[model samples]
Target: MYKRAQYQIITERLKESRHFLQVVLGPRQVGKTTVIKQVVNDLMF
Candidate 1:
């Protein structure tokens, strides 16, 4: 599967030792949920 650039960035941030708030901002109808779900699911297992 082809992942978006945002996916890599989000994944990297989440893998860090230090925690920080990551707010995803964008217009409506975008794949915000898709990216988030992909990231969470990938990290879950």
Candidate 2:
């Protein structure tokens, strides 16, 4: 599975709407997109 170290932190910030936008970036298959997608998915629940 895709993973990273900072997903939780970024996800938390997203919940708060503390920023206008959150950008996830990294090498392919490295979990940058995964983190944001996870955040979005989690928010729906």
Candidate 3:
């Protein structure tokens, strides 16, 4: 499986901190959006 580091981090944060809002900040094309998309997809299933 292709594991994205950011994806893992986001998922972990979401699981660990349900009350806090998670934010991803970086330059363009740095996979911030992609990570969120992947996280959302995983959560759906």
Candidate 4:
């Protein structure tokens, strides 16, 4: 499995608390959006 560090951390947090509000903060072009999108997609399936 090829997972980014941020992706893994966010995935674990989401699994721990599905209802919690998740905020991804960072400067431009840092893969913040990408991580959340990937996580959301994974959770859907």
- Find the candidate with the highest TM-score and give its number: 1
lDDT of 3 at 20: 88
lDDT string, candidate 4, 1-45, tens digits: 456689988888888845698788889988787788889899899
Q: What lDDT would each prediction earn against the true structure?
A: 0.90, 0.71, 0.82, 0.82
Give per-candidate clash totals: 0, 0, 0, 0
Ranking by lDDT: 1, 4, 3, 2
Clashing residue pairs in candidate 2, if any? none
Off by over 4 Å in 4: none
TM-score of each: 0.88, 0.61, 0.80, 0.78
RMSD of 4: 2.0
What value does the lDDT take at residue 13 in candidate 2? Answer: 79
Candidate 1 residues lying further than 4 Å off, grouped into runs, are none
What is the full ranking by TM-score, best candidate first? 1, 3, 4, 2
Tens-place lDDT digits, model 1, residues 1-45: 768789999999989999998888899988888899899999999
Error of 2 at 4 (Å): 3.6
**Native-to-model Cα distance after best TM-score fit, residue 21 in candidate 3, in Å:** 0.4
- Model 4, position 28: C-alpha lDDT score: 100
Q: Write the per-residue lDDT of candidate 2 for residues 1-45, one digit (tens) a residue.
A: 544568678767776845657666678887676677776777788
Residue 45 lDDT in candidate 3: 98
